[model samples]
Target: MYVAVKGGERAIDNAHAWLAEERRGAPDVVELSVEQIREQLAIAVNRVMAEGSLYDPDLAALAIKQARGDMIEAVFLMRAYRTTLPRFGTTFPVDTGQMRCVRRVSATFKDLPGGQILGPTFDYTHRLLDFKLAAEGDVTLAPEATEAAPEVPHVTEFLNSEGLIEEECRTDAEPPDLTREPLETPASRALRLQTLTRGDEGFLLSMAYSTQRGYGRNHAFVGELRIGVVSVEMDIPELGFSIAIGEIELTECETVNQFKGSKTEPPQFTRGYGLVFGQSERKSISMALVDRALRWKELGEDDSGAPAQDEEFVLYHADNVQATGFLEHIKLPHYVDFQSELELVRKLRREVAAKDEVT
Candidate 1:
């Protein structure tokens, strides 16, 4: 007996109701507030913002709570929310050279123009679990203010002064938005960088690591990694002037890579750039390395057939939302296809048996 089930709408409604209950949890347990998530689970919030391409910590936190702490789901929620937002105006490209950095470090030079500030990093901290954190939080005093330091220009600027690094031309061209249009082959540098910013951090890290392992080894040095807030300004056509719309936290990484000069050009250092939303230095640094690896052909370096060197491969697999959606959609019903295959196999066997007997 074939029982035709038809309750798609009802099922969806029930699922949503259940999800709402799950997100809320027990009444006595106190619901997780957006502010609490933003303040307490800052790292998770940072990851959400980085992948979401939205800098609002509050919205990221809310998405996180709604998604039951699933960072990728939170990122998806943010992306969906951002898509509905109407375009007010475009911001001029932020000059990272003018960034008032909270944390700035360079691995290339020991003593550069701007002294390295390690800032708040867990790199040196032991991996051991702290039982005290589970019981109670510790209060620490704020450091005394010191004299303001001079604005540090980019390290690449110094290299450019000596004709060592590749000089980037100042262009007034507007870059294409990846979200608004379908990505085509032979993407512009701007599009590539935009894709990399919201790309999966682990995937980018592994690709970058593969390059270091001689897959497409272009000797790379972290020229600079800076995390700070930058003002976003938009030009008002009616007013004939640019105004500060808002401020967003950003992490920018610039990598200096070795390049052999061609016949026409002199031997000089090339650069790879990564700029992402929020305090996501790891993602930004990984992005920078991958960016350089992908530019092997442009820099006159031979393609070593590395995954990072393949733009189609890298860009296609970077976004978690796209990857996850296609992956999870398989969970939906495919019984009809399975049953057809089953019937075909049975028919083939019956025919073969009948033919053998007739022979």
Candidate 2:
């Protein structure tokens, strides 16, 4: 292929101009507002915030709009934006037990302390697409309960009472941040969880599906799935008090998996925890399944050599920005490299033909 000798800057500028025009599409159509994307296309914003590791919904929404609804691109933008900001004091770990739950469901128990709430789910909705909603409609939702759920009793707490599940331990050890440090093999459970929470949803979904397909089968039951807003508090050293910073929506999933006791330990059910920003139930649940599958070695079980179980493989390839950069770099100029390969291939062919003729 012929390589362009010049005009890299000019070509780039023109391409960007065309892209900008394309992004706007036809000006005749009503432009979509950032608020519309924030409130209406909330799932996209949630995914961006979760993957981007930022909790600002408005900023996330703006990123989504600027990225033209491309979630990975939005996440990329948010991550880039996040680096420019100064790090204030660290917030206390959110108390999910006291979360004002918008939705709570448990497969383990039909009747728990808090009854199953099927709130704001599409589980019962038909898959058929409605053409009527193509243009925005002025339909209003009927008001229901104004009262918030006081507290959600954890599903694991019940199993823990009888020693049926693994205990949830609180650790003050600061988890190593992958962004700030290079990821090492045999990662700590805390670090692994941090990676999984920010991992690509599609990748996690596939990894979880592989487990069900006998890749690393761990019989998992969704012990609890809760989506709600939780208060974020930070301890102020000067004030000598903890103050509420803000509230952010979170989707937390706890998957209980069957485990037979190893030679060193007694049999007990294991738990995989997934806590992500916003109402990302599917991603959160998928994360939990994958999280459980990765714990085989730590639990004293044999390594099944599954892709999800490989910390190096999952953590490295899970970031879309990193993956996409290497992927998209293929489209850039490779003339010199291609020409070298081409000449080598032709030289080998000529040698082979000459040897055949001589023979």
Candidate 3:
């Protein structure tokens, strides 16, 4: 058996010093700034914030920079730092209905009260590489003409009018925090949504894709996808009223799934919901689809046994940091365990040889 080596401290120290130098790159090269990351790499920052469960753009950008653009690592940094902060109070539930939207679209309806406002989106952009950015450090663009967008009513509202959709309910129930408590199976709807919102985007996306490929297809359409800022308020016990604390940019998606019915109830459209920080439409929509798939039990649908439909499976595996930690731990020292297994295998081989000789 191989013996364990001693004294790794010096090597570890030297390795860290080398890592620091590598992270900084060459002395002659210009370093990336946190502000640049916050502004230019806003999508990355948004993802960090979403998974980190902390909405500070500046902090998220700093985490991204410190992590060297490893998004899951950045999220880990933000989440770890957030634990040092003390909670002052909880904010009242955000009213997405009052959100002043930048982008609003409906796949179900042709025209709504507010015309489709296509904000800064690359949905229709040609994906061809723009080499102009290589020569020019920065390019100025003409100012956009602004027109006030009218209030957009939710597409689900139209379905509700005809009683063809499940009734939306907002309860005054307190949600269980996964961060604060151990995760339990058969999770509540609120907990499931919370987990999905902070889940690894890529994992969630892949799971949602699986459903689309007929694993547990729910036939979801983007009833409405909106991104905008909404005011956050907090109740002051002494003041006996709630006051506006600040505003946060959020992306909200409401998905209309296939109709569900039984002999007792009429067929009505089911709903899936997703909300996240910043302009993460893809994540939001994917989240909604996955959410609806997980709600198969409540909707009286058969369990297709899809991964996304498995609450325990999805919730347990959705955290990238946790998954990476367990997965990457294989790189650590396992000499003792390996040696034990080696001895067992050798003993078994010896026994087999003896038995063969006897035969």
Candidate 4:
């Protein structure tokens, strides 16, 4: 306390240098290659991409490494990077119906026109830790496929054919970008789905779980979950027609929720939709359930005063990056305010003592 605090600039520079060093780790140790991080730590990359709303795997991987594997911090990094990117023209809605599926499954039906494929999942794995991964990893060969299968149509399409679920109208309307536009009340299904897609995975999961636990229970079943690469098309004004822009991996979930018949209309099963970047089934499923819960007003269901049913609460607080930034910012600097409060408390204490003495 007695020594004068000098070298503020140098101290800041040193701190930055130390931080960079810490991020990189030992010089002698093998550095984590970006490819390694993308392939091996795909879940982290998926979370970053989903929350960041940016699809670059390499950048997500780099951000994950720089953030020291903190998913929220990685998402923050990706979001920061995303803000600086120049906007290209928007793409037409992805034709998920035509997606070349890597994995497709349905919980509502045992078998459908397109057979269920388990694909790649850790769902059946035991909780035990694998010690072999701590040492040099063993490479495994790719499994050979024995048969070719027909393309799987969406499960909701089957329901649509029978007119069981509400028919979704196809439109030429462009959906609002949540990143560019401020979220307004009474959001469209597109906007709501967009918010939920990038929402905090754990938070959405808990909210979805709450729905099953009877807080505004919708009795949701995974009507269909599909993961695959889909063609992204854009309308070139000059060409006067849409053309393929690029392809991206996506996870799409559709949930069937119970609906009560209203006075005007017959009770039919309603749909909740969730679509996200990459192969994130869990997050997508959670998003679908939460989406349904938020649709209470639109579906003419009573507002049950549940957190999941609150659109503002769910949409605003769902992003882990925003939550973490606001929550952790308190650690930055508040000493001046604290000192003022401390002085006020001390003054009040002295006045109380003086009053006691007089008494």
Q: Give per-model TM-scores.
A: 0.91, 0.96, 0.95, 0.92
Estimate every model's Cα lDDT from 0 to 1. 0.85, 0.88, 0.89, 0.86
Worst 10 residues of 1 by lDDT: 141-150
**Where does model 1 exceed 4 Å of error?**
1-4, 145-150, 349-359
For model 1, what is the error of residue 230's alpha carbon versus the real structure, in angstroms, after optimal superposition? Answer: 1.1
lDDT of 1 by residue, 122-216 (tens): 87889999887878678454495533234688888888889999888556778889878977768888889889998988889898898889888
List model 4 lDDT by residue over 117-231, tens digit each: 7777787889899887788788565587633234578998888888788777556688888999888877888888888888899999999999899888889889999888888
Write the residue-wise lDDT of candidate 3 on 1-359 in tens digits: 11234557767778789977887889898998999899999999999999999999999999988888899999999999999999989998988888888889889987887878788789998999989888866767539854435456788999999998999867878889887887788899998998999999999999999999999978988999998888899999999999999999999999998775966557889899999999999899989999999988887788988888999999889989899889988888888899999999999999999999999
| Model 3 regions lying over 4 Å from their true place | 1-5, 140-142, 145-151
Expressed as tens digits, the lDDT of each residue in 136-204 for candidate 2 is 687567487545577878888999999999887678898787767777777888888888899899999
* Best-to-worst ranking by TM-score: 2, 3, 4, 1
Candidate 2, residue 81: how far the Cα is off, in Å: 1.1
Model 3 clashing residue pairs (backbone): none
Query: 189, model 1: CA deviation in Å?
Result: 1.0
